[model samples]
Target: MNEALVLTWAFLLAFAVLAYVILDGFDLGIGILLPFARDDDDRDIMINSVAPVWDGNETWLILGGGGLFAVFPLAYAIIMPGIYLPALFMLMGLVFRGVAFEFRFKTIRARRYWDWGFIAGSALAAFMQGVILGTIISGIETDGRQFTGGAFSWFSGFSMLTGLSVVIGYALLGAGWLVLKTEGQLQSRMRTLALPALGGTLLAIAAVSAWTPFRHPEVAERWFAWPNIAFLSPVPLLVAGLAALVFYGLTSRRELMPFLASIGLFTLSFIGLGISFFPYVVPESVTIWESAAPSSSLWFMLAGAAVLLPLILAYTAYAYWIFRGKVTKETGYH
Candidate 1:
């Protein structure tokens, strides 16, 4: 029961995090793309594209954080202290971005201010998330169950690269989303922007891949071993296929494929990262089982998760289904 519950909750937590990153990622991407829109009208339409679903999209972030705190307190305690500033700043960024979304349309006098708030918030949040991920991948220094790293230990060459990579990745997702949701000149412009974002995203992936092995020999050996190679090779192959599809879709003026392809790219990357670090929840610092809460606690969490998680997914699906369409000047945000 302990074994099953631990694995189950871990998987649940992982799923929540994935959902948060992918769903919130595109809207944040849209916000990141705000500055580049041709005019105020274009900006409003772009905002309108995600207006219906952005807030609901963030529910997954809450679930992810809640799950971490509940099911893996030990890991959470260590991680929070280690990267407190980035995490706090990330939340502040989200707060400002959320406010911008609410106020960007209401007041004409401060609409421009709100636009900059949205853009800055999105970029800052995305960058800080990358820093968090990079710090994890690079491994946190811990004494027993507590973090021992310095205040700025999270800032490093690799972490900065990861932060940049995440920004570019989200922007790419946003561009693909715009291609799917906008029309005419905006669509063409997004397609043009996507190519470079795609290129930059791939470059960042390569840089991280090159640096990761030197940072973590365990991952290097797992990635390079014979049977593991056979098992893992498909991730990169599928990523390549999706990248090609995104390029082809953009060039052909295909609407949904570019966005779907970006989703595929993210999914594959998530899978690859999971495979690379299966047993470790906080990289080398903590294993999943070591960090898991008590079995009795997990039993309660599991029962609650079984009910709550499905409800979340149901509402999430319903939201996307309801909002599925092109964003235009005609479609007003309520």
Candidate 2:
């Protein structure tokens, strides 16, 4: 395809990924933070905070994955086989959490079981996503057309560290959502969670920065090169500054701004990763052009997405508008 078309497609794919991370990130964060909730009341408050927006948030994931599958079939084919287990686990986690979310509020007696399921599902999903990311960053073991690696090979020490990092990242998002949507003790509790989660996330980013390049020399070189280095370096700096702002906002009791700032941090970091691995879809294995489906197929998929994606975005915005306000004890999914 022409360069302009390629670039436009790339940008759309990137936006979809960013939307997924920001939208689903918070609900997953809520799920991760569920276990730390002190009691049933706290849990209810936490769930309510995300109920209006959680499902809509997941639309980004669908958009991102579906867009990639349509536009870049080769990348999808290679990466899917390599990370199949983790991908399946992530889906299961999301499904489990989604099911538990509805069931949890249906009956008082079954609430505890569903709550635990939500927590487990959220944490599992987050960790699996991180692991998949780490595996991609660490380089997948692919031999020509297929993944030659063992089944459990994706679960390494480095992958686990990335998983933990994601857990903290989600917690930070959850904390921010709570800051925006709740008040009183719950807000205070979220603030308490936000600070440490922010610290852990930063540390994880640092570690990943160091480890990723060491593990993959090409990526390291791309990052350290003069022009690329200068262009991409601002991402981390922005992330750090936003993180500090988030900390300050939380400490000063600024409320809603902390969540916004946290989202900024996440967005910047995500952009950095996207920039670092621009042309490549499956780490070192496949480039976007190489893995792209036929032009005719892409055109067809693009047409469908053109209609569906906007409708999803509009409905999501409408849902958020409908539920805009502080959550209360009386307000819940019954």
Q: lDDT scores for all predictions?
A: 0.89, 0.85
Query: Which prediction has the highest lDDT against the true structure?
Result: 1
- Per-residue error (Å), model 1, residue 6: 1.1
What TM-score does candidate 1 reach? 0.98
Pairs of residues at least 3 apart in sequence or in different chains that clash in candidate 1: none
The sequence of per-residue lDDT tens digits that candidate 2 reaches over residues 1-334 is 6555656677888888888887888889999988888899989988988887888788788878887777877777777777889999999999999999999988899889999999999999999999988888777788886778888878898999988888889899889988888888888898999999999989988988788777778777888888988987877788889988999999999977888998898787777787678788788778777777777777777788789878987998899889988897889666
Write the residue-wise lDDT of candidate 1 on 1-334 in tens digits. 4787788888888888888888999999998888899998899888899888899988999998888999999989988877888899899999999999899888999999999999999999999999999998888899888889999989899989999999999999999999998998988999999999999988887788879988889899999988889888888888889999999999998999999999888888888788888888999879889999899899887888889888989998998889888888889594
Model 1 bad stretches (over 4 Å): none
True-structure lDDT of candidate 1: 0.89
Indicate the worst ten consecutive residues by lDDT in candidate 2. Answer: 1-10
